[model samples]
Target: MGDYLVRAIGYNGQVRAFATRTTETVGEAQRRHNTWPVVSAALGRSMTAAVMMGAMLKGEDKLTVKIEGNGPIGPMIIDADAKGDVRGYVTNGQVHFDLNEYGKLDVRAGVGTEGFMTVVKDLGLRDMFSGQTPIVSGEIAEDFTYYFATSEQVPSSVGLGVLVNPDNSILAAGGFILQIMPGCEEETIESIEKHLSTIEPVSKMIEKGMTPEQILEAVLGEEGNVQILSTMPIRFQCQCSKERFGAAILGLGVKEIQDMIEEQGEIETQCHFCLQTYDFSEAELQGLIDEINA
Candidate 1:
């Protein structure tokens, strides 16, 4: 499969769960940003979690995840919507470090142990829902898990992983989120805790060719205990386009356009998300100025 997410419930709806395989999606991001292995792992894990959170929204709703850490990687930003479209970028994409004590990509070293995670959700309402939580772990997954429990007041478990090839391309990326519903039985919670303790890192499972469904099965329980609700395709999709950049140029007003035309004869604007560059020739800049005037 290209890339996809799974939405399901387990233990008779006492647990709300999500799982996704984002190898292709993260690979595209790595290619666009030229992220090194540690940077790829950091950005990929954040995107995987953000996309799963996006699935929790209703139609036309979206969310943005920002991780501003004190590490060398600086800040990472991700945007995801209800339709499984996600895009993201890191402030510094060339960061790398020796593996940590556990022999994993030193994501914490890249992400840093300080700073905050902020999530802004646009529910198509007059006011957006925003939450901020202290970063409990530099690892993206634990930080999001903390966000849920502290900011959203929902007890949840989040697992995210990304493996990069020696060449710094994405090898596998995937994650899962499990939430305990109100009034969930104690037994069910204990059961999930036990499974969580024993399950392998999600990236390893994905590297081993496990699908989202299988990942959830391993996390939740046997096939019978989990009820598959729906599946949505996921991908790295950017909302940027030449017209959007043109409109932004128009917003910059005629004076800036004229100055750019005089100085460079043309201008190039690159999108932070996809790194696609849009060029505006002198004529195009003049047209935008004309539109601004009229």
Candidate 2:
């Protein structure tokens, strides 16, 4: 249907896996950001992986994925929570390049290899968890695989893909994460590796209308080894609003509001994630100032 993900255990709990279809979600991002082909692919791939990582969290937990590479596309930031809500934006959305030798969008050329992928997890604890790893591959998927192995000590296989149309809209976007649990048998690893080597690209599978369950089946085999745990609906959702922004404005104190009223007469704020603009008139600013005085 729209956009959703599936979580499952394969090989009798030896491996935990996730798969998601994010065509619509990425399409929304493309429209919002007006990203060129390569930029769209990079942002979509990061969003796809971040949402699956989000699913790994529990209640009220959230995470931010940042890719700061020394490339034309600049930095990309994605925010996702345990409830399947996600939103992101790239610093430079209008970047594209010729296809690579593989005849795929040159995401690596646009994203650059000399940078870091940082993940910050807000687990509702006093101390948040943060991990940083080098961007081994600007292709996005392999970079995350490396992050899990080197930073988190989890051996994981990540497959992320995004296809863009001639009109620059998203054609297909999806991904899968397969993590080897502790005590996984060598035979199970070999079987999983075999399937991984032969399976179609995730974007092709999504273009073929494969559901997340089917993707997991393709990755983990079809011998009923994959036991689905649950499914979660996902979408590009931004947690920004006028009231929230107004509260933030109020936090700037009465003097700041007065300065804004004197300088601009009205205040306009734009959300970096969704590009939604919010305006506060002089009267509204005065009211906030009065509240601050009160």
Pick out the ten consecutive residues of candidate 1 with the lowest summed lDDT. 219-228
Candidate 2 versus truth, CA RMSD in Å, comes to 1.2
What's the lDDT of the predicted structure labeled candidate 2?
0.95
lDDT score, residue 135, model 2? 96
Candidate 1 lDDT tens digits, 106-195 = 999999999999999999966699999988889999999999999999999999999999988999999999999999999898899889
* Model 1 stretches with alpha carbons more than 4 Å out: none
- C-alpha-based local distance difference test score of model 1: 0.95
Whole-model Cα lDDT per candidate?
0.95, 0.95
TM-score of model 2 vs. true structure: 0.97
TM-score versus the correct structure, for each prediction: 0.97, 0.97
